[model samples]
Target: MVRRLPFLLGGIALFLVNALTLSIGFGFGLSGVPAALLIAAPVVLCWYRPMAAWWLALAGLLLLTLLGPVLSDDEALQYRPWLLNAIPAHLAVVYVLALSVRLRIAIPAFVIYLAAGALTPIHLLDDLPNAIAGAIVWAMAVLVAMVLGHNKRVRLTSTLRIAEERGRRLVLEERNRIARELHDMVAHHMSVIAVQTATARYRLPGGVSEEASREFQAINATARESLREMRHLLGVLRDPADPAETEPPPQGLADLPRLMESARRAGTPVRLAVVDTPDPLSPAAALTAYRIVQEALSNVVRHATGAATRVEVAPDETCSALIVEVHNAPPDAPPPAVERPHPGHGLVGMRERVAVHGGDMTAAPTPEGGFIVRATLPLASSTGAGEPSPDVMDGGDGRDTSDDQRIDRR
Candidate 1:
């Protein structure tokens, strides 16, 4: 609306010209057409190039003031030098200029506008009274435009700053969460290494030589140091504002139904089907799978709210990788609000997670004006895991037939 405001004002200026020119009275004849375009051109241009628009506005006004009397077929307006219609167009241009540029720039442009307005009325046909009214009106328009434009710009700047800071905070939080998870895994391994190295000399059935014992001591020391550094790094990554010292339990495939149900409660029609893996996936892979599904569903809820969403998690034909696909059908009704600011991964971090396990993902819009996210996370890490049992999984509001097993809800 802000961008188009200038254009609308420009259109109003043109409409005024057209309405006046078509009336049963003297007009600028055919010359008024060019003059109207000239007057409105700046306003239309303001949205794209404010400085240039300001210049065009000034030039148009000058041309009209200098030539309006000669070109007018009407005697009363011949010596007017300026028309009231120019006021709104000028205001539109100035408002956009102040809103888009810096205060210093806007102030100088405004002063130029004021100087021209103050001087233009010097040769008015109605002399002092009309000139005084025109000057007063022009001053008020400039004042309003300057004040509102600057306020709008300031508010917009503040909003953008807040958004940027919020994004940075989210990134930091994600880093801390990942760091804690890494610390959990790496710390355990480091502890084992330290214990084994410390006991190596004595644990051997045959006692080790002094030199070998010294090397074992060195190895144990290095492992302990590394463990210490790792802990320190985790501490640094952890958010100080977070009160919890322990990590949250990681999400897995079992958590997906709950995630979908949550989406259902929020007005998104969602269905979930998970083909049970013959062999249970590793924690990391399971978590990856859960997050992939979670992110896709969240995006559907955010960007395509009220859409009928289907989620299918199964092993691929080769039975070597798990395939997760989320398809959102067209919504039956308009969304409650313009889609909210969707910071959720449509498939972003999900892609990186899948890639870590040597898998692939794809997300795109459906032909029916919906969206689909598909991913293949290799199940080779878990043997005999690819094949999915025929099971119906209930996500939200419907059920589907399956050869092996199925969970359906409607």
Candidate 2:
């Protein structure tokens, strides 16, 4: 109420003054038509629209001009040619000011209205000064309307952008919270299950059935492996700048042979071959390549029991790309399909890894009863020839002398 006190008092004051002026029937201090429009235009624009306010202005003009003489019983002013001319002219100016709010009016329209209104008193009442005063009043109205319209548009746009940014930040925070919960649950439960299974197996004596022993041993082994994979997934989500972290293993073309050997131990025969691997890939490129193979082989172990797998890692000189392809073919009799489904996270993560360095990947099943996963990682210079030449990955040569398993956590 305090903020609006000044406006409320000013409006009541203006109404009293306008009424007194009309009642006295003295010559209008500035022309009665323009004075009323100047006071009412903004209030109407705020509460209503350009067209409705324009109609109101028109009706008001008619009442003020036509009824003034009737109320005052003054024939001298009512039929006066100058008063008649000025009345409609002022109404036309009000209509233009209202229309300007709804459209982008050209400068010519305002100029023409001012030019014609400037001659009203001169032609009708032989008074040039009054005509000039009326022209000045109309010009100021157009200026105020343009400023309000521009300010309103800018304020609305800024408010919308701020709201959109706040919404995006909320969504990102929620997703991070959910991911943390998933990691903690998987790690704790799988670790506990593996430990209990191993304890149960050791307590059993030779008198126990062979089937029971085998079942306990397999369960223990599988659960332990699952726990390791879960830990790796959690580590990937860690912020890189933390001081307590250790570097993860270096995974690139050279690791393919060892990965295949690990699969062979699990009773899945794997053939590994490497070509054009004399030069090591960049760290990002290497990690993406490793994940592609890891996800594919992990799928094979879970879904294609007793399957034969082969991995091919080759470099295409023409394209400057490291091509990795992993294929798996199960026995003639299809292995019982385990309902284990890929969560799409592993595949989506692989693609995100490749996309960071602008590479491509594809995953699909072959018609020959096998699944295939392939990726082509580009190994261009990290700096793209735009910076000072960088030192090679290991000294000046392509060979990386650092321990292959050592990861640079810092």
Candidate 3:
């Protein structure tokens, strides 16, 4: 409705002005008022009822052409040619029809207008050149209106296509993320069960009874069955159309040491610390914590090369949640600002991960010219089990003891 406002206002103004001009020129008598109303009807009706407007315009043109001599004195008739008087209403009807109806309907109306002009008696058959010129000009105005309507339809179709493509892309990305989360949650528990069962079987004393050994074997079998069911469930959640694409399982806190080692090798000096004894984390919370640190380190590597970073993980005193923080100092010689990639998608991905687990995360610049990312993931009662599993680390302290490289910067 709002889109039609400009056309409505412009049409009313044009019709009123034309009607007043013609009435004043003809001395405002009974004949002049009726003729002026005939001229103005098409433009006014074009706004609400365009098809009716076209019919009214044709009737007005035919009336003026046939009775023009009787309605006006010779002086008034000589002042304006019949063709000139008909042009405004004729053009207004054609323009509105072209925009409001299909080409099949609008073209026939134009043909009817031409037939009416041919039947009129005012034009002398001997004046062939003038009649031909007038017909050509009227046809050209109708053609212009058709071209304008065609361009508008083309632009609207293109806009709708672009919007549809964007919506599909967003839905595909979200499905992929959900698949990743499911794989991470199920795979982590299965891995822990497998590793723990194998370790217990190997560490058993030589004098162990046959009954205890069979029980160990039974536990291992149960864990393997659970893992097989998990794989089938994950397959159902994945996109069936793209069977060739497979997503790897997501990493957790256990993978942090390897991630830090990779960053160190990439030339960023990193320090790791765990202030309190680490507790076993649920798969969702662990994945969220890992992703936050991963994205933060990735940003530092991409934007703040030659900088030093620190990663800290500690359990809350109440054992209700785990706090994780990744901090990176500004590079000794900062890179150009334009060299940094736009941070839109990466930050959005991090926020989505945190929101899924109902965690709070913040990334901000520090007072001493550095960047820090802090996250707190709420812990569930089922997450508190034994100590950190051996599959993630081999030592009691949650620190990587691999080769460390020290670099000195001025």
In model 3, which regions exceed 4 Å deviation?
A: 1-6, 26-70, 74-93, 116-129, 189-410
**Superior candidate under TM-score, 1 versus 3:** 1
**Candidate 3 RMSD to the correct structure:** 12.2
Highest TM-score model number = 1
TM-score of each model, paired residue for residue: 0.71, 0.36, 0.45
Candidate 3 has an lDDT of: 0.63
Residues 250-305 of candidate 3 have per-residue lDDT tens digits of 46776778777767766678777654434456667776777667677766666676
Instruction: Estimate, for each residue in 38-150, the C-alpha lDDT of model 2 and write its tens digit.
Output: 43443334233444544454454445544445444444443221242333333333443433443354244445444443443444355456545654665565545544544
Candidate 2 wrongly placed segments (more than 4 Å): 1-10, 25-133, 197-200, 203-410
Q: With candidate 3 superimposed using the best TM-score fit, by how many Å does residue 33's alpha carbon deviate from the native?
A: 4.7
> 2 or 3, which is superior by TM-score?
3
Clashes (N, CA, C under 3 Å) per candidate: 13, 0, 0
